[model samples]
Target: MTKNRHFEIFLATSPGLEDMLCAEVKLKGFRQPKAVPGGVTLRGGWPEVWRANLWIRGASRVLARIGQFRAEYLNQLEVRAKEVSWGELLRTDVPFRVEVSCSTSRIYHSGAAAERIAKAITETLGVPRSETADIIVRARIENNFCTLSLDTSGDLLHRRGHKEAVNRAPMRETMASLFLRKCGYNGQEPVLDPMCGSGTFVIEAAEVAARLNPGRSRHFAFEHFATFDPEAWEQMRAVKSQRAPEFHFYGSDRDAGAITMSRANAERAGVTAYTTFNQATVSDILPPAGPPGLVILNAPYGTRIGDKKKLSALYRALGQRMLEHFKGWRVGIITTETSLAHATGLPFLPTGAPIPHGGLKVFLFQTDILK
Candidate 1:
């Protein structure tokens, strides 16, 4: 557990959410968090890497930048790669893989670079290399400088490992958490998703209210490293906060199957006690019996060639319902087009940069407390 030495820890996020991830990292007390292009960078060792994978909600993945060297030739790359302390980093019994990318460099063959690095590691650490291994070493050879980073997160952090059922175009939990933060939600007030697909928004809100760790149910890649301390990792993962929330999160959909999936997903996440799912349409949606809170949704806006005439009606109905029953609540709509958001006729503030969803660019349209 190198308690004294630290490495450059990078927390990856969606393209448009680097600053939000940085803020979350800083609030979690990681040392010197700075927002770079696609993620947040900090300084920490193995324990910090574990905590990052275990705690941060807005991050997509966590990476540990192990070592770097300037090598204009493949022989120099192999020699310097052999100098790295692979014995201290990787386990001899575990399998690993290498992936390399080269740009504007003398040693521009990515496959050759990967081969050299893999040979060096296999010879030095006696670890078997597999093409399908979960543990990976990523190399970026840009401007003739080779930068090495280890993917400490095996699976993407968005997968909380609890939800077995997901609806079409489902929103990821990591992105949902950041969207909630963008809507100024601190988990104090109730959250409702009228068109809740798989209960992602509601379940995430409930977990936040309970102060549950997003990564609690998932396994991280760092757990397989030679330097991993299972006892210390257990202690870190076991810390629970006392700030429990009392309000409930609500979700409703017109499809009975969606409601069923929502309930099951919430149950699997251990938040069913604080969540309520109902089957209803946009016209039938109603606010919960509590203080006015947030009415957020990822309504089904069709693809580029989708029927705009019908989607407009859906947006209008959602807007009408928000105005009728949720007078004091704020609203957030995640959609692909501005025209659909405009059809709602709600007074929206300036929108944020386009966020890359599954394959489409989605925008978050928010409003002030409704009049």
Candidate 2:
């Protein structure tokens, strides 16, 4: 593709996080970003695709719309698919996979449509099709219109190439980043996670404070494409706008194993210097010296097994601790139950939309700076 040509680049984010991801896109200087239901769409070429994968922390995947056509029958689908410049787009050395989904179209059989497209590509480009390939070509047939996109991010972006260990209460990095952004954290001050399972929140906050790119240590599927430029990608990725953080991010967990996992994950993420993980219970927490910032945590929803009463006591303890010691600090808690959040008894502001996490929908209940 030419440098001046603009393609439709879609950055996929979790549900209820579209607008927040759009704000990040605008801040990163992407052109004409519009937030939609499942993702945010913008206009750019290959470089924009690379930057979106490398820079955007909230996006789960970056999809580049490569082709679009109308196909009513399998014959028409094959013809249109052959017209696509697959050879120019993908290298013969790299095996690729095709995924198809159909809705309200004459080509109702998804398997048939996929096989047609796969056969066309194999015949034309002679590239092997693998059931599991890092390079993915996705097609959505909706209302007789087919739109093809490259899943430039093969693995989900949340696997940030660090964090070899995690606790039972695990949170994906992408969701953690959005929740932190929703809490009005702009990397200006300190952050703490009392129930910091695997240290997702604390480490994300520390990375933001240091101006580190989340995708720095990972490999994306886009690197395997024929259009990838090694020199250009290296130079762009090498440009680090790192800022030394003034305050250390804090995390405390009752589980000693959780604390150890948090420390190791921070070291792998290269944020150990900017973070401090303590083995402490909620009642034992003391606000760090120097400033009052944000205290955010993803608390247990008490979904599995029993003993929700004990969980309620845990929430009450957290609330009491925040009220008594964390004066002037804002608080954000994510939980699946409203009653549990209310049990915290912190004066919380109205919450945002519920975010789908695991099998449950969790809400972020935030409080104004404590009195």
Candidate 3:
């Protein structure tokens, strides 16, 4: 059993994606991480923090819970903030930034409260505060209680620090993982996306199948803290190669440009060696030589283009293709319109939740049997 620690860590994700993120955390071997409103809360120590930064594909960011206190007013907030031992978490040479959010408490102005907390850090620990610091600690208050957290993962962990070439309407990493989870993808079998724009589905599926660390290539803010252990981080990174699988991940896009983008994105993700990218339309979709598994697609949902009628034919054709060719394979489609999904013609059950994708509401449609 991994030794338990007094600390709590949170892995934040976009709203409505919490369940998927929490499931991914558990699948990656973290102990009981509870799904919260915007994130998952896990009980662990610094080693877990390092592991979370190196792994945890679905998290938008990882935060370490440093302190929690009740403050009905600014005077109480300042006094409480000053009492905490900021020196233990910060150093004079290292600069930091603070973000604040408040709800249902006397501390109404989050901006002013954040300023006060930043001032407290500078006054109490002598650490300079700056907007562009490598470290950004956040304080959130609700019902007159404040919880302070340090962002362990920098750059909004969803950035993955990869995907230099992404097309418009590219899916966020957090959303991709959540969608994969909802589609029942476990990285244990073959997965493909015929409309793999930016390779979000394909890349995330490959990452899971190859057992690659999603955050491995990125830098985290926790590294700057004085308490961050280099040895622990190294140990976490050393497991990268041990997790790779022995199979190829497949993805194809109708757009030649999207195919190129997926290949480039997969290359940067270090999973290209295990990925196969092709250029083909849904009509050209074919079964892989391997056993059938999950098939997920995020096609043009007629969202930004403002032409549902034009895309209706496209969606209808896609449904016909899936029904005719993809028998016995689990199929998942994400789209913004119920009528567009109906156009697919394949019998599907609504996943019953709205997920935020590309600033539009997307619902997942799944069909277990092509017939």
Candidate 4:
């Protein structure tokens, strides 16, 4: 936490979309981004940390690696933890929380490890511990090596501070952005979502096309850190390079209420001018009049026996509509069951790994532009 010292920054994402997130981080100019299992990693100082929280769309949370050490025992762990320059990273006036996880090391009890680290922070930095604190210190002891990091993103990044309304099983904005990226959306092409619950995909696509920063309307936990520079952050957030999108994003759903929600959410997200929401069923869907684009939908994959039977027919109808009307449009369908995807008969290429979403494992089934 020394002044201007670079540290490892971890961008957390859904498990199956690490490569997509890594590509986004690399495009955003993060230094040497490397894709790991659950996320991406890079090295930078506090300014880069601030930028990541402010601009990156695919990351679910941002963690700043403050420091690490080898600790074989609790006493040694406590001593080393206390020696970390907590004052440089945390404010004594801010209440903070410590979370610890131990694996394959002598520190088997996570609670005891958390308590020891909490005690060290309380005694050395004079910071009060609070379970409800927004600032979080995370410690992981794996194979006798303890790495400490700060959760710079207090709430999950998907809470983009917009979209007050949502439908049942709506896709989060973080996951939606990554899915759009996986579908080869880069803001130039228009996007359409036939099952646009709450308009997540359409709104996210419009934001990308307009060059709007996902975190523009939200706040981050790093604002509470001792290293926070409000002046610098103000400048960073103010210098948005937004442009008017030439192509419009589109969405529709069978339910009238979902269309209302989509319009409201798009207006709240400041993309209403660039988006259009309509009330329609799968068979009623048609491509917009201008050009070929991407059609992505999070189709319903019901869990119950009767629900699955109903959803299969729904998927079949949707596929039939796409094949008949959406020629020249690429498609990305997200569903928990490949059987449902196959029911579309859309000639989907090799599917991506299944991603965990809303307690179900979902895969992205993509197709080439239909002839």
Location of the lowest summed lDDT over 10 successive residues in candidate 4: 301-310
The residue ranges of model 3 lying beyond 4 angstroms of the native Cα positions read 1-5, 241-247
TM-score of 4: 0.98
RMSD of each: 1.7, 1.4, 2.4, 1.2
lDDT of 4 by residue, 1-371 (tens): 77589989999998989999999999998879999989999999999999999889999999999879999999999999998999998999999998998999999999999999999999998999999999999998999999999999999999999879998888999999999999999999999999898999999999999999999988999999999999999999999799999999999998999999999999989999999999999989999999999999988887622288778888899889889999999999988888888999899999867899987889999999998
* lDDT for each residue of candidate 2 in 1-371, tens digit (9 for 90 to 100): 44446889999988899999999889889988999998899999999999999999999999999889999999999999998888768889999888999999998998888899888889999999998878888999999999989999989999999879977758899989988898899999999999998999999999999999999999999899988899999999999899899888999998899999999999999999999999999999999998999999999877832366778988999999999999989999988889989998999998878988887888999999999
The residue ranges of model 4 lying beyond 4 angstroms of the native Cα positions read 304-306
Tens digit per residue, CA lDDT, model 3, 29-116: 8999999998899998878888887888888888988889999988788888887778777768988998999999999999889988
Candidate 1 lDDT tens digits, 1-371: 24457889889998999988888888888889999988999998888899889889999999898888899999999999998889888998899999999999999999999999999999898899999999999898999999888899999999998999998889999999989888988889999999898999999889888988889998989889877889999999888873557899999998899999999999999998899999999999888897999988887777743487779988988888888888999999999989999998899999989999988999999999999
Q: Taking the candidates one at a time, how many backbone clashes does each contain?
A: 0, 0, 0, 0
Q: What lDDT score goes with residue 227 in model 3?
A: 74
lDDT of each: 0.90, 0.91, 0.82, 0.92
TM-score, every prediction: 0.96, 0.97, 0.94, 0.98
lDDT of predicted model 3 = 0.82
Which one wins on TM-score? 4
- The TM-score measured for candidate 2 stands at 0.97
Kindly report which residue pairs in candidate 4 clash with one another. none
